[model samples]
Target: MLGDMILRAFRLTVRVSAVVQSSCQCPALHSCRALHSSPVLWAGHNKWSKVKDIKIPKDAARARMIAKYTMMIRIAVREGGANPEFNVALAQLLEQCRNKNLPKATIEGAIKGAKSKQGAQYLYEASGPGGCMLLIEVLTDNNTRSHQEIKRIMVKHGGALCEGARRNFDRKGVVAASRDGISSEKALELAIEAGAEDVQETEDEEEKPILQFICDITSMKAVRSALESLGVHTLSAGLEFVSHTPSLLNHAQLETASTLLEALNDCPDVVRVWDNIHAQNSQGN
Candidate 1:
């Protein structure tokens, strides 16, 4: 009986040792197997995951941009007229819509809706970071709801609503044209003849030069027509609120302001956001 008992004790010790050894070796074994096996597949999956993360936001942004442009087109038609040729704003907006690759059917529907006066236009003003002024344009069927939603978004982003914010900015008609086919001198001459108040040339994201013509709101149609008659095709032409007193923001302040503007713009009813922050590049109309 004593010999059997000692044998049983030895077996128990051996079993415990085996368990400890397995516990220690399991992690290393898994690591080795993972290293020797299909790391390429894992890497490919990780890469695809990263691409998906990047693309989903971009696709959503594109969709939002399309929707905003559609709303702008509709508003333009409603305020001016449905006929693009007769309504300069609508004509310019349609050009921009085409440039953005908005669907033809969607554009037509917006025009029809606008002709029926289906929505109300709104302008919201706010004070942003770095003492910048913000002008948010919105169009919706419900003014009260849009106003509340916009105010909420602004306040959430450390901004507050302001009244009569247009007093801080100058309303002007802006026309953006590419410098692809014409010389700067010729573009300037045409713009001046068209009653443009200012002519500035700047490069786009592609480093291609773009010529911008600023004119009185009353002269937008004339300026556009004159440029077109001279064989100068404009990229965009619309009304803009030019800051009377532009504010310069430091890097940190600029970042904060940009974030606030983006948040405001993401609101579905927001058509365009105008700010007083000085920027090297001008936004599309």
Candidate 2:
């Protein structure tokens, strides 16, 4: 779909290029000497603007995706090392990057940068709208600076730094698998057979269904292996601070909570922000 969209944009650009060239060949355009006036470059004044408008959103969305993937890859590299051949987490992440059509050059660049430096990891606990408890993860050389920036962003979004947020979360192993054609009953059965402590169903950024097989932090690789042997393609295997106490959010509260999350994630030093927010109408909230 992205390729087709780019092809369409290319065709439009080619058509516009011819129009621009024809204008450049005009005798009047060449003879014009007005200091305040410029020759018209295209058939429509908004043609270029329209092209930019068409391209910018796609590029921005793609950029956000790459940034997110880059962060994940960096964390994988930091935890497991840069060699995918020996790093199971990194290997799975690389496969996911390919599946999502991420550029090979971008992947390589991220891996290279990931090996350059290391930072102390920290977690910021906060409470947001709708009683949402947040665990904001940070990786930084300067803890004071990162803390100030995160606190500012949180406060700006009507949230504040808080204590006991970590108490609501438990670090556990998570193995994500595609939920295509997989029923709830089937997911439960898979979890049971794979020795997962629990299973949580969720959707990815693409709105595709996924099942997170949760287990002890040390059992991530084993559970992922079991899932794969059982014919379930694993998307990622990692440890996460899974929230145990969920906060139910109404429509307005949900909107505010989401905005707060976006703000938190935008901080460069912030790695991941886990929350215990569930919509009031869904997830038995």
In model 1, which runs have C-alpha deviations exceeding 4 angstroms? 1-40, 115-117, 179-195, 199-211, 221-233, 279-285
Error of 1 at 29 (Å): 17
Show where candidate 2 strays beyond 4 Å.
1-58, 75-80, 85-89, 115-120, 281-285
Question: Over the stretch 1-285, how does candidate 1's per-residue lDDT look in tens digits?
Answer: 999999999999999999789968789877776787788779899998987998777788778878887898888887788998899789888888787678999889888877676688888888877677888999988889999998887777777898766778999998888787777788778877878987777653234688888899888878988888877878888888877787776677778887888787788888998877875333311
How high is the lDDT of residue 8 in model 1? 100
Against the unseen true structure, what C-alpha lDDT does each candidate score? 0.82, 0.84
Across 11-65, the per-residue lDDT of candidate 2 in tens digits comes to 9999999978987888565556443244454436567787689778667756776
Error of 2 at 102 (Å): 2.7
